[model samples]
Target: MKMIKTSMLTSVIFSFLWVSGGTALAEEPNLEAESAILVDAETGKIIYDDEIDVILPPASMTKIMTEYLVNEAVKSGKIAWDDEVKISDTVRELSLETNLSNVPLRQDETYTVKELYEAMAIYSANGATIALAEHVAGSEGEFVKLMNEKAKEIGMENYKFVNSTGLNNKSMDGQHPKGTKADEENMMSARATATLAYHLLKEYPETLETTSIRAKTFKEGTEDYIDMQNWNWMLPGSVFAYEGVDGLKTGYTDMAGNAFTGTAERDGMRFISVVMRTDSREARFKETAKLLDYGFDTFTYEKVIEKGESVKGKKALPVSKGKEDAVTVAAGHTLSVLVEKDQKEKMTPVVTLNKKYFNEDGELIAPLKKGQAVGLITIENDKDDEYLQEEMRENVKVPLVIQEDVEKAGWFSLSLRSIGGFFGEMWSGAASFVKELF
Candidate 1:
């Protein structure tokens, strides 16, 4: 959908020239992580995959899902930024724990949804997260169901959300979300984590505006003000800051170790990266930098196929019964992909008419409408790289559409054509018999 933003056929695609082939590639980064992956945020193209499918505790990184649901609630008018959320005993008690990330939420105190969400997203505050979850779902445990439901709806595989806060149930003080075990924790594979981030950024890009905040005071100027610093060190002016690095979640626990879901955009290309079970706090961001560096240094986005570009051999398709015998077609829109800086020529377009538009005998039926998509031109490459999420494969494809309307043939014309076709078949059969006899 990134390339589809343009008017389907009006604008011209400028030549994006890059050096193709013959240069040595930067040595692929060797990561000290249990699982890691790097993908183009726009296309979900997997640039680097190291144990990507391995399931691991996601730590506070679980908040991404919470953030997504909050956005959904706000957008659906189920909740509002200005809505007051009264702190509960659970929230008050959790905020008192000195070990967990938190902002003070006093009993009987009510804060706006906007304030709690900023605390949850910016500071990874567990207490504020639970308050927002309860505000949206009536309870944090009920909110866990929403998280898993969303994960499945969005194509995440084998993901488990036992709590809304990405904290261990044991850490929940006997108040873990219902239907979850006391010892359980939130779990997701590297691929699933990146996929969640992808949908979060794509569906609700505004989440970044909060995540990108380096420092802010919660309820400033009041006794309630708590100076909050974003846990993501990769943002601007922070230690280990990486340019173009924006808002994303970070996580840590004894079982999950140091993990980060980091995203950065450079020169119009953005990448989402995940590193799980890295050694320490510093290592997570450093490892994420390696991934971000690899993506920024390695690939450049390219629109390999222009809108209305003719597929090399597929100019038109035979119609089963139409005023015209065939319908002319071309690529309905542009085809874009993340190509290695030196390997632009490797992308290939594979064209096939959609079977849904064809009859049982594989004939396209008419009347066919002009500008209606009839086929797909999929991008293939010599590398055969797989996407981080299998569903993202659809991103590398564009529709092949008819060039003009085709009216159905009149019955009289169809009858005449049918008579001619019968004679033509007879003649061809006789010729074949003659050739066999000879």
Candidate 2:
């Protein structure tokens, strides 16, 4: 897979001018969010982006990492969902803080890891998040170290995590661990947040089972029962409920404004959108819906080449000192790329022969085997003669492989071919010089 920036409105504007001979460009969606991004869930392709790399506060969206680590622990057998965790005094006090979002827990009470995870995921409960972090790493400070490590491993650029709950030290009422300042808060760009969401869903898709719960009761049927609701409004029954929308998280704070990471599927195409620092809570979901709609309406995955199919107009490669004089090459796999509906006609595959397959004299070597990679096939958009103008846009790349084995010729045959090749080269050079003189 090749990583390339999605064709943004700016690029599209230029493309329109070049394609239509100076015609007016089409209008694009006007999003109200401060930062936004859309990505293909399966390929991590950025379909749209606006100020996506500008770092900003992430608020409770940070809990996604908290939930992710907990799931990792369970999968690794380090902990079980059914295991009981004793509520520490620090966690109980943090839960009681009036400024923080939390579900109250008794200091003497014990709750299952699964129960706490649900509270943290659905409600963005800071207390529950801290409790889980401590349970996983033995201390909030240690857990925070793990959070940064995981973020780095996931390829997150320009992000920082001061706490698992996403709260600045000011919101913690001076409860922050030593060496941490009061104003520090978790921060990440919208693009990095989307990247994190992609890996989180890819590795543990079952997390959707928890994030999709619209409403559920913790400690059901007991006097201690507390009802929790998912904060993400993109889910079903919400004001901006979108079809096929499911599991993800939402976040907000005075510094972070309103933020959300939403995922949806339709006709086998799944997408992830991240909107951060919107003016209002509703704007986050609204912008996300627009992004997803743009993606589904504008682009689609089209297969441009089939595996084992020979490249059109390409000749077989000459094989020196081989029983077979030449060998055919074909695509090793089906090549598919996401392209705009109208631009599909411009998509073309260009085959580039690998220099390593040839000898110093530019002749293909013998003993070539079937399925051995011999070249690269790059998918390019050539409408408006972009490729000829040196403005080529590459979407994806696949390998071209030899289609059959070419055994080396015997010693006697090799000697004869060498002599013939030398004479053939000399004659070709003399003919080229004579044509130039004429």
Candidate number achieving the greatest TM-score relative to the actual structure: 1
Q: Model 2: which residue pairs collide?
A: none
Candidate 2 lDDT over residue span 1-438, tens digit each: 122345476687788888986644234568988888888776676767788889999988888888889999999999899988878788999987767778888866778899999999888888888889888988888888888999988778889988988887687778774456788988999887887888789899999999988888877877767788788888899778888788698999999999999999888788988899888988888888898888888778887889988778664778887899888888889887766765655678888888988988766899989899988887654332221012113336678898989999999898888999999999999999999999
TM-score of each: 0.88, 0.82
Model 2 residue 27 CA deviation (Å) reads: 3.2
**Per-residue alpha-carbon lDDT of candidate 1 for residues 1-438, written as tens digits (9 for 90 to 100):** 756767543233222122332455567899999999998998788889999989999999999999999999999999999999989888899987879999898875669999999999999999999999999999987998899999999988858999988888997779887788999999999999999999999999989899999999998887877899999998999998999989799999988999999999988889999999999999999999999888888888777788988888888888888998888889888888888786667777878777899998877898989999988898766237688667678888899999999999899999999999999999999999999999
Residue 66 alpha-carbon offset, candidate 1, angstroms:
0.9
Error of 1 at 280 (Å): 1.8
User: Among these predicted structures, which one has the highest lDDT?
Assistant: 1
- State the RMSD for candidate 1: 9.3
